[model samples]
Target: MAVSHGHKGINFAQTTSICLNFIQEALLKHQWQRASEFLQHYFQALEDFNSQKRQVALQNIWKLGSAILYHHPKSNVETFNAFADRMKNIGVQNYLKISLQHALYLLHKGMVEEAYRNLNQAESWRYGEMSASQEKIIKLIQAYRGLLDYYTWSKKRTELSKFDMDGFATSAATQDMHSYFRQASVNLHEIIKIPGVWDPFVKSYVEMLEFYGDQDGARQVLTDYAYDNNFPSNPNAHIYLYKFLKKEKAPEDKLISVLKILHQIVPSHKIMLEFHMLLRKSKKEEHQKLGLEVLFAVLDFSGCTENITAWKYLAKYLKQIMMEKHLNWVQEGWSSRKDWWPTFHFSYYLAKKNWKENKILALEKAFTSGILLGKGCKYFMYVSKQGHKVQKKSIKTMKKFVMKHNILDSEEL
Candidate 1:
């Protein structure tokens, strides 16, 4: 429960817990500086301890390092360097886990040479002492190496202009860079084949292949590393797969599969909107109608009126259907919603018979909503020209509305 350090008996577990609590609280409050101080104190307290204590200390330090990297990147370089030095001083015998963290930090900081040195030191440690997870970490480091090689080569090749190259020189150089990156991609794929390196390993390879204009290759990599039925559960992964499918111009069925996956993952307004857009583009009339049905269902369930854009779209669609079917309910349904009056502006252009009346009504509603004009004399003049046969009550209403809005001075009005 507690370990005595020197002057006072330190409750190691309690102190660690307190430190973690402080770190999380500070992070939640966006106090990165205080969080970093607490983390440093926490890790320093665990130094000079034995293996079990050191493992706990190292894990905390690694987490601290990750927090610094993600949340306080610009100001945490010194913290990262100090952590790296601490890991190095722990010696290769105790450095397997920390090595990957240090290497990643070094790579992020663009110290590729130092990162490789750390990786080499980690590799030279006695293999039999290493756990299976540590072996997986080493494979991930290999994948990181391949990533570094590909990026470095790509940078160099991009710096060379086409005009700077002679005929044979250009051809030869092009072949070399292509071959190098292709090999790097292959090496990354090989690491992916080794199970348990899922997150960054597969993600990085997918990104690299996608960046290199190899959509098919990237899709294949995802398929190979696929998590069986557990797939389509991650919203981000589903979005990525959908993008790839869209890029490939895969059939409507494939796009529908992604929409289904998205529906299963999380039922949200955004997902519904994307499904509607995709179905509309795919020209699946039945599916588009289904998407509208789903939208209406979600609207009823959530009562989410924040999406004015979706409302506008529905209004336009309803207008079209009303014109085609000569349905009064469609027009009434659209006109009843005061919040959606702006959408009827588009309908005015397409309302064949009632175009003029609809246009005037849309403008009137827009003016009343304080949207068309900023309470200027010009706006009042424009409203006057509408010739709405302003009654005394209507004039009183206009004056009250203008006064209630307080949007302009008396002289301005």
Candidate 2:
């Protein structure tokens, strides 16, 4: 239900807060179905509020809509289209993102003509310098449009059963299709030059080039663009660079050198994890010591708030090395963002550390927070003798699946 300003008691902020709190609760409970239902009411409330305070509602709707889209990919097309219409009603300029989402969804469903129209509408709205986020969205739309045309033409080229009688027309269409990919390549390169777009653009650009059998060209383009700005801020670019170097058969030293530089610039979760893997794979005597340093550095850098993959490996390695000094920091980081990593995963680590006092509390907290029983039951068994009162049928099914997969010891879902 939506509250209007005309309602005697409630103000707009209270109504908005109530809606947001509802969404948050649904998300915390992993109730995507409930969240989807709440989103409809939230937008209705926004519409009612907008009827009175148009500007305020217009400014806030995009953020909430984007959040819903990001979190609820399974949201139906009707709902998504409604959101796009709302955005268009607010201002055509603000509809660019929802327009792109609509186009992509249509394209995925093989609605080519409708997707093309949506893309054209998005393209027509381009005018001035936009926010970094908006520019990224625009670039994505352009890249998708180009790639879609190329794929559509390729499909046409393959279905040449009737082309025997109209050879000239078929050949002309083939040439046009080739031109589509070529034009797309050029457009993607231009998009790559835009700030905040380089990382994503490079992935698609490189994929396009490699798909056309120009691996060397793709590597060079990625390298040139990534290194052009010496102080690289995007961690994915570095990760991509490392991947390119590895594929090219570069030596371990060269890979390590690049990772060293990458870690200096943007030591993100994936990057740190990759660097840790490379160190372990190299397996030199000093590599172990160096890897531990890098692992501790990652804890310091990110506060252990991200990268459970790295944390798992680090925890196992610490067990091997018999290290105990930095364990406190590890615990701190894991506990800080219990929502991101499974509470059982962290609790398992705590159990191993002989931190029995915190282990049960963490398990109870995770249990109360609604972590899936199937995902955490094994860890719970390790730290506590008493079961979590999980359904017997669910536990039996989980055990069968775990035994079949031979991952009974794994902490990940």
Candidate 3:
């Protein structure tokens, strides 16, 4: 569809599709700057259009740009810098974020000099009429600047010479360590006070504090970072506190508290084995119950269905629960979770010998999740000694579902 704008016919839909194609072609050839230029032209071509098509096109454009920029390790200074400049010229609202993201990538790659340059550029983007979010980003940019300066100083801490900082040479000599340390400390201090979780910033500050023999300061910052209410939740911040407490030889309750929150937030976290082990050893009745709950959560995850370690823990705990006459867990949460695990399925369609065959069991174990149900295995619907009434009902339901969804029955497979 074409619309007339100032005596010129512009087609928003066609232009958007063509522009995206051009951008993808550039990306396939690793031409970042070319792709960015195409995006800019796309925006300019639709500058005067105010319609649903234009709004949807703009959303797609931003999503494409974000998806491309998120892979920072694949980008370089020259190409990213060119792309960022074009985005800035196009007045992209998140140009600041793009700059900081690339700067972060540079820092991770040990390119402190380039990271510093990019951070400085990001700070420059924080010009007049800043919104609340932009202001927060500016503070983050400053904190990263401090981090970049500290990294630069640490690499040359053995020297007593001048070094480059923000494109100027400074002579802190041996004192550069403390100077950069204080610079980072002050910036991070401001950031933490803003009531948000700054994991990396707070973590780095804690390391510096520990190196400087300030234990109390490290503890305080970590506590605040973990327990703050600025964001919904941050699981790793709890992890940081947990490790720190273990190092400080703090009380068992403190470590347990941290791990409990972490488990609630991320049930499949790899470090949860430590929490499970700790709980399993506790003599408290409540702790044992919590331990069972944790095991169920761990196994419910799709990736963890075959996790042997988790299965082993569940086995030991289930044995303990049965011996203690606690059948409530079986009828409660465990049954729902067990429904998703493939290893416990009971199908009755085959002969008794075939049902007890190890080879058939192994084959079923190799498949994930659904075979024990009435759906995929109409002939062999459950692993139970219960009568044919249940089996017949399962078969009827499975047939209806199969007919509706057009899924192949067991005979076909």
lDDT of every predicted structure (CA atoms): 0.58, 0.60, 0.63
Instruction: Name the TM-score of candidate 1.
Output: 0.59
What TM-score, over all chains together, does every model reach?
A: 0.59, 0.50, 0.64
Which is better, 1 or 3, measured by TM-score?
Answer: 3
Q: Identify the runs in model 1 with alpha carbons over 4 angstroms from their true place.
A: 1-51, 61-82, 89-94, 110-113, 120-127, 160-164, 191-216, 222-227, 230-232, 266-274, 281-286, 297-305, 318-413
Model with the higher TM-score, candidate 1 or 2: 1
What tens digits encode model 3's per-residue C-alpha lDDT throughout 312-364?
56655655665575656534544564444434332333324333453233223
Q: List the residue pairs that clash in candidate 1.
A: none
**Number of clashes recorded per candidate:** 0, 0, 3
Tens digits of per-residue lDDT for model 2, 1-413: 54344667776577766776777787777776676666666654445544555545554555556556656758666776677777776664457766877787676667888898888788768656677777777777787776666566456556654457567877787677667668667767776666553665577668767767898888887676657675346666767878888887889877887788677776655567767777867767566556666765665543553444554565455544533333333333334444544443444564445324443343332232222233344454453443445434433443443333321232432
RMSD to the native, candidate 3?
11.4
Per-residue lDDT tens digits for candidate 1, residues 1-413, read 12224426556666676777777888889888778778767775466366777766666666765776567746566766676667656555446667777788788778888887777776666645677777776777667777766666666567655358679878888777777677577768877676543555566667667767887788876655444453334566566666677778888778777667666556563766767666656555566555555444334333443345455455444434433443333323323343443343323232222224443432333233332223443433344334445333443455445444422232322
Best by TM-score: 3
Task: Find the number of clashing residue pairs for candidate 3.
Answer: 3
Model 3: runs farther than 4 Å from truth? 1-43, 46-76, 86-110, 121-130, 153-174, 195-197, 324-333, 338-413
